[model samples]
Target: MAQDYSKKPIEELMAEAKGGNIEAQNALAMLHELGLIPEASAAEAARLYAKSAKAGDPLAALYLGVMHEKGAEGVPVDKSIADSYYHMAEKGGYHKAVDRLTEAGVGRRTILLVDDSASFRNVTRALLNKCGFDVVEAPDASHAIRFLQNGGRADLVISDVEMPNMDGLEMLAIIRGRLQKKDLPVVMLTSVREVGVLKKAKMLGVQGWVLKPYDNDMLVQIVRKALVA
Candidate 1:
């Protein structure tokens, strides 16, 4: 429930937040984010907002989404992270997030990340989160296909080229055949520099390729380019 925070002092709000009051956490976050508090800290506001958001506060989710979307004050602009937060806010019954998502033009831009390595997926997921894209992970091609067959939506696909059962190319071929949506963009990630794989990937409409040891900035640029292209 929303608290009657209009009359509450910052000190009281802080105490309440420390006591694990979700409403107070949201209120203090708003105060700090809006600079209503004396010598406010945007970082602290962001931290509180994250906490409240995790606790299922729609307002906190909305605020965090906007902050990350616009890179407000001390926050870095991360559209993918912003997208995730907006999705959470909308699911939590915040209508404003719907409008914001449309305004950002990425409300439906979900990326399917298929890989076998947990560490690679973790690192890539974090990077994609910062880029403000909603990411869904599938450990291998078969899982990715299952996700698609179950009607999960993905605007783009990033798959590791080599995996057990089905490789990225095989998965893409099967996916294309099953979905009958051949224009869907895909990027390949691989450590192997194989002429045959590259040739087939190109023939199969792979949008881009990134080697295993990718530079963060270059990866971000590649993702951005593929998304736009």
Candidate 2:
């Protein structure tokens, strides 16, 4: 007869965690923090979370921040520690860290409003905020991504077709692929009235397209459509 394995002990799980397995570490941390195991240890969980974060796990840093903020299970609450972990996660290219920091009142809605002309970004940001959106200005795609990585969350993205440091099409592709956002609306505002560009916008799943020298009515309509869709 095969030996019975169903009655496994808790010691095996802790051993796996101590052996440098991140998943096992996270699991044991959760079990201990939640009191599902015999010894509920928030400090132990914090240590495990720190270890995982040092190993480049953004989620671990996020959890560490949350646990520190909450002061779970006799642990001292520390907003500074939480902010540090959040910063680390943001620098690791996690976009949701921006939202987290914003919700925590430690940051703001930084919309990387990418346009070549400073006048354009300023005008667009004013208009967007008037319609209840917070905007951050970015001169190009690389700058926009940098802003995003540093805890910026633009509710909507508006980009011009022509610019240095990556064109609108390339930026759109990166946003769609790497941002991991569902129903993230993008509006392509461009001077280029070429049919090919419009067709490509459709192909790339752009929510709206507007030509340069845009009318206020057109802008409002496109923005409404982008938000609704």
Candidate 3:
């Protein structure tokens, strides 16, 4: 899974990354993350780093930890996820990730949770708030947009798809287009299995999803994985 590379050219690196080489993936991800190449893209960097880190590359894990900590474009500010990646790097003998982790002291990450049902919000708020998230409740998409428009700060958004007035996707479009918070990660809580809706959400840059009526542990796990990756 891990092979030592001897300073290959960009073409070679791209080829190796395409062939599922973890080190090559990390190397190319670094070049993209640093804008060292013409094809520099934060989303692509995050995707490559995620693949390498998932395959247990220490350097890739460290870079992902930094991206989560700093809220880089493709990744958001998620201390819980950042710390987990740092620990993975530490286990792989990379001490720099741990050093930076100790240097940055911050509070719990905040999640803007938009749902129309007051009862559902209460349950979700209790669940996430207890699990290292500071959840901000928005009864609907309009309220969510109002909060963001009023200069509200949210590290992530977890919103339900269907509601009385505005659907979550519509609010997501506004968030991506007008609000110009393209990097802000969003997760959808949806019962609809329509491929078009999910594709639209993907085009709008949603990070992940949790189907409606989700298990408590599974929802948290999905949120954590999305936060880091």
lDDT of each: 0.76, 0.68, 0.77
Which structure among the candidates has the greatest TM-score? 3
Q: Is candidate 2 or candidate 3 better by lDDT?
A: 3
TM-score per model over all chains: 0.54, 0.49, 0.61
| Rank ordering of all candidates by TM-score, starting from the highest | 3, 1, 2
Question: What is candidate 3's lDDT per residue for 133-186, written digit by digit as tens?
Answer: 788999999999999999999988999999878999999999999999988889
Better of 1 and 3 by lDDT: 3
Report lDDT (Cα) of residue 7, candidate 2. Answer: 28
Which residues of candidate 3, in runs, are more than 4 Å off?
1-18, 21-51, 54-106
Model 3 clash tally, residue pairs: 0
Across 1-229, the per-residue lDDT of candidate 2 in tens digits comes to 5322122246876786688867777666655653445667878878888988888877678777766765665566898988888788778776556354332222333345789899888888777666555677788888876766676777777889899869988888877778665466788787877767766766677766677887654464345434432
Q: Which stretches of candidate 2 lie above 4 Å from their native place? A: 1-111
Clashing residue pairs in candidate 1, if any?
79-132, 80-131, 80-132, 80-133, 81-132
Best prediction by lDDT: 3
Ranking by lDDT: 3, 1, 2
User: Which candidate, 2 or 3, has the higher TM-score?
Assistant: 3
Candidate 3 CA-lDDT value? 0.77
Q: Candidate 1 residues 1-229, lDDT tens each?
A: 5557655777999999988898888768756754446787778888998998899887677767766765655788898998888888888986556464443334537889999999999999987777677899999999999898889998889999889989999998887786775877898877867766766776677767777887665455445435543
